[model samples]
Target: MTMATVRRISECFVKPLHDLSQEAKQPIYFSPFELLFLNANYSQKGLLFAKPTPTENQDFSISTFLDDLRGSLSATLDHFYPLAARLATRKQENPPSYVVYIDPENCQGVKFVHATVDATVEDIIASKDVHILVHSFFDLNNAINHDGHTLPLLSIQVTELTDGIFIGGSVNHLLADGTSFWHFMATWSEIFRSNERDGYSISRPPIFKKWVLEGSDPIINLPYTHEEQFIERFESPKVRERFFHFSSASVAKLKARANAECNTNKISSLQAVSAFIWKCVTRVRRQPNKSETICRLVVSNRSRVNPPMTENYFGNPIQSVSATTTVEELMVHGLGWAALKLHEAIKSHDDTAVKKLVESWLRNPIVYKLSGLFHPNLVHFGSSPRFDMYGCEFGLGKALAARSGFVNKADGKMTMYPGREGGGSMDVEVCLLPVYMMELERDEEFICALESN
Candidate 1:
């Protein structure tokens, strides 16, 4: 009936009910890929919604729901024990370096926050502004942080509304990749749904073995920063984040058109959409003809690994592939031309190639200079079509909507997820400077390709 209001109630650290004894604990060595996240500046946040019970008497209460969730999370942690551990540095060497492991004393547990909002789940879902929704549902800054040797790798915020509840999980990028992170969330929901305390089981038990991928030598320590200053500058009120939905039919048409333009290759929906958006963004910027621009696509190697890491392998298993083209080439090229180049980059990194990439990084370990915030011309893709966003049903129900509370704040960032409405559709979340967004929203080509609903 009126504007919604949200307020925090309480917060506490949630630890596992059972302790991981020192003798039983093990340290999983960080592969060069996993170590990259140790100083990565971003965390992921996901919200799952629950509708009110369908009874005349409102028997359910927030306290009871939270208690159940907390217990279930603890149980899930026992299986995902590393999540509760800290990222401690090994200082005995010449320079300090990080080691990934879980020991009894180093585990600080995950932070759990309780909050309430004077809004209905439907209202929050209907709101168009992602920033408002994220701030209303989460305290983004405090969700994940690295302090000294102890890194609180994960934190969760649960918000209760008049008609429903929203669960937010924020995980450090270094601890797990998007696939592994969602796997943990799904397992937590399963444990709660089955109400299985004893003999609890998971479909895919996460493989914690890291030595196989860990190279022979560790490199010198390099200072890493999330570039907080760079992030703060663009996080001004002038920046805006907007959601652009691409219906299944719309994506099909784009793919068909792209394929038709290039007789030699057929493009994927992702490449088509990416090329389409990239052109629009570059057009909006209207950079000089002499300038060089690049598009970064994060490719996951879970399937491409030597033996193929389990779908549930728990660590960073992704690499960034970049394609650079001069402004003249990018602007003059047809969508198919751009799409073809993007497709080639994605295809080039097969399993053996990915293995070499990891080995190369191990040999000369260095922090990447580019990030989601470090450059304006660069665009980084987030999440994949297989994240199973819609199927992420907790005991309450399937989520009405789900989005990244963090990625939306950065400049030159784009995230793709499976549409909540199903039918193999996809949703794209784009963040850009206000001036560029103004141009993009007015571009007929971009506007015509997108379906608002």
Candidate 2:
């Protein structure tokens, strides 16, 4: 297979078409939950391989397609204006603070890049080194969320393939989580599909109000004296990323078996799958029975908050909840027992728990670091299978596959996406040491669970 080469065609910024100069430009303060992502960026890329219709193909042109995408994205930005805004820092403040707000007077629009790949879509999808190849599809590969002050908070790249197109988006994690990221992508696709028609309105316009815990300071102050202190970079170790598919049937069986063993129906499919992965990872690492392992799950606080923030509430309203157990307990307790531990951790993080986490962060601000989150003994689960990843159709058919960027690549980092077949299926993207990945692929128990039913 020939190595895919991505050539940059053009680069520009896309600003909102609707003017908001008259509106009050209040900065949307980042909550403690959102501030946790100050050091990371969320990057995802989707592949669309559906062939165009005969009539459409006759007149299809890459130039025209890109024009439509740009126009629709401009319209979508009218609602999600924060994406075009810059992260501003008040260095003169008592302890220094950061806020995201659009300066109508001088808006730094979202960075847009147009590129072309010199290989077929199949070459990319079937490549053994796909994880390494996908890094070229996204922009801001080396930037963190803190760089948003000088860089665009959101960067999008449209790469055309011989048989398909790849759309990749990189957004500051502090500006949006997996939910908000997909929300913007879905809305942009919807607007693009409605471009030829009239009287089209956004079904879900984002709510951009800053969510603050009652009685907590709206402005979160950092403990750093210089902006340089916020810029911490790490060169991740060599690892391999592989996708594990769990069909709906297999997932259901896992869930059923877990509930049967636990003698309770409260075990969700996510918990069951998480438990299975956690145990498999622990076993593959060959940890001692007395060693402790941790599984950190990223939980959304949108509905868990006091007032229950709307699903459209933009920005990161997520918190990480972990379930820890010794290797012996996790492996010996069986899948049901392991799942129950995850289920309890998720269920116990209620409104009060969310508030308590915020209060604790206020007293002591600690930015997330790869060293603290990702490790050999820790499995950090990010993203979600509930996101409508396959539904991001921009006049083309549904996506053929989804892949993440180079950012956040570390050992034991797993991201979950809804399977292409849908119907409760999940695609677990796992990054691990090369030796561990080789062991995981050869693990009989893990292979049987995925192939069963």
Candidate 3:
């Protein structure tokens, strides 16, 4: 476990193992969750805190600013090869492991590199100082891979512990997500505060194929008659919560009481914080005659599709959302049927109802086999002050914290973003069932006393 000099820097995309075919081979499932992986030896990496000591009065050269972002990481990986050739179902997953090798197989999704010291305790734990790749993908799965082509992922060694100054590399969360990884590190500090920007030239690249915003009717070909319906009646359920914090002026007074309970005068502060966490998870889990069926709540629809997802291709742009209940069924009918069923589920942003709900859950093969056999809990959402965490600078300054992650699924899997303060308010990380966000402020005090009427 002594590997460190990980200097492949970037641009290492591999898809041509003679471009395999036999109908484009993919189905490879060898689970047992790879016995929870763990290749050990972080060698005091501290995940991310005290190992990016770049100071010239806060201009600490996290190793020559990641060797100038790994020398413009292969022209920012040739602008994500037009989003892996428009989201390839072929063309060999559109290219990544751009030639850097030494894979030590941590599970197979390969990409791990480290180093450290301390960048002022990573600006004091903002987004837990950039989650050292969630314990290196919960102990290194398939040697860790963030799918670009073959292998290319994980490289976080942030150190600056009082000027022992060091900065490291290897990052490929498809390309970016954490608000487009601080919007490509603020477009590389606006061309590294430009002095005629050096070593990079990627002229336009981002279409990542999925038919350029697919959901008009695309899910690897989902058409089996509007699919998904295995209904075994709610099993391992538990993820029905709605937390609240409100006091940045009650989040602009609950975003004008969720746009006057969704009269749709337009809403965003993420649809009034997801209509106040979907009316406090329907008043803490709908029991009495339960089944009004309305808790989906996930939403990334990446700029409402159609040539929108640029900012360098990644994975799941998301969509589950359901929203509405007349600002929460006006607690037994009143304020105009709770603002018109919460304004027909937050103005039904229909792209053919988001492509027949992603082709009815990919033709509903029992929608994830009855949601992993009734472990149902899929109310996901992640907004994060719409990506702004003190401006994610990764050169070891800015991004004291901004959070979101995935892959721990079930027992209530959630992945909401934002809320590490100066994200300006609202924060979530939840895997919840460990409850107590103070039970969403005791049902947010009866909807802030019916919005002070």
Candidate 4:
């Protein structure tokens, strides 16, 4: 397949239609969870294929469609004002700190770009080099979270395809996680759809108030002298990413097998699937020098906290916990044993554990960087299958497929999304060294597990 050329047609900043100056504006400090993601950005793209409407004979005007999207996005920004706000630094304090606040007087709106791709949606999606082609659909591909001080906290790119459209979004990880990101996207679509019909009302309005951990200072300081020091950028080695689909029946079979082997029903489908991937990758990458392997699971603390945060809370509240084992033990013990290890690791990270992590980070601020987080023997699982990704629908209809940007692309990085078919199905997007990926694709045991019973 040939490379898809994305030509920029226009670009502008989209601000809220309503005046934010009428309301109180205060700087919202970052929670410990938010602080950890100061070096990363979450970028994703959703493809929407055109569907025939009742008036199929009428010509579809791209200009009209762009106008509706811009108008709805502007109105949606009224509720999610933080996305339009810029990250500010407190230099006068004893130790300089970072805060995200909406400057009503000088609001820097979110960046919006209009572009056209030379390829069709089907061609791009079906291409074997899709991992490289999808990067053009997003903005801020090189900008990290700290760049938000000067750059827009959120950037969106709408690319027109030959047969459909691609809506891509890139938000600072410090501002929101996958849950909050999709929440904003769904709301934007809701408002857009409402414009076509009747009344405009969002089901869930975002709560911008920061969540403070117990016994922790609301204002957290960073050790860096300048904001530039916070930026840690590195080009990752060439890696291939492939999507592996696990049907509901296959997942059920794996879950049952794990439970039967462990003599306990506590093993979850996620754990079982995670164990399967970990084993496959470990077997392929196992070296005599490296005997240990670790699987880091990204856990959400929204419902795990003491009083539990609402689903509408708009910020990052996630933590990563690891399940470690020697290669010998992992390989000899089999999938059930590996899954139980993951289950125990996840179970142990309760409310108390969450608090402890926050306190530890407070004492010693450690920003998560790609270099420090990844290793040859590590499998970093990010994102959740529970997020309502396919539910994001504008007037165009539900998304045909979901793709991510250049951020967080590293060997051993695995992102999970709900399969397009839903019903307990999962799509695991795996990134690995080309050699390991090739070996994984050829692994009969791993491939066999994906088949529905």
User: Top model by TM-score, which number?
Assistant: 2
My TM-score estimates for the predictions, one after another, are 0.88, 0.95, 0.29, 0.94
> Per-residue CA lDDT of candidate 3, range 250-358, in tens?
5666666666654556555555554445445445554343344344554555665554665454433554555433323434643323334444664675566665654
Q: Give the Cα-based TM-score of candidate 1 against the true structure.
A: 0.88
The reply for model 2, stretches above 4 Å from the true place, is 51-56, 93-105, 129-131, 196-200
- Give the alpha carbon lDDT tens digit for every residue of 1-453 in model 2: 556678999999998877755553566677888777777755555555554656767887789988998888888888888888887766545645544333434567888999988777677677654446678999998888777878887888998877778899998888888999999999999999987323357999898777898987787777766756655676789789888889999999999989999999999999999999999999999998999999999989999988999999998898889999899988888899999999999989999998888888889887777555565699989999999988898978888889888778788988998999999999898999999999998999899999976
Runs with alpha carbons beyond 4 Å of true place in candidate 4 = 21-24, 51-59, 93-105, 129-131, 196-199
Local error of candidate 2 at residue 348 (angstroms): 0.8
Superior by TM-score: candidate 2 or candidate 3? 2
Residue-level lDDT of model 1, residues 1-453, one tens digit each, is 576667889987777768776653755556667565544544565765766675833776678878888888888888887777766544433443434433436778887889888777667666665646566565445332233145466778898877777788777676677888888888888888878755587777887765255445433343323333122222323456777888888888888888888975469988988888888898888888878778878877877766777787787777888777987898888989989989998888887788787677666666543333355576667787668766657666678777677533456678888877766577888888888888888999998888533
lDDT of 4 by residue, 141-202 (tens): 88888778788888889988877788899998888888899999999988887883223567
Judging by lDDT, tell me the better candidate of 1 and 4.
4
Question: Each candidate's lDDT (Cα)?
Answer: 0.71, 0.83, 0.37, 0.81
Q: Which pairs clash inside model 4?
A: none
Residue range with the least summed lDDT across 10 consecutive positions in model 4: 96-105
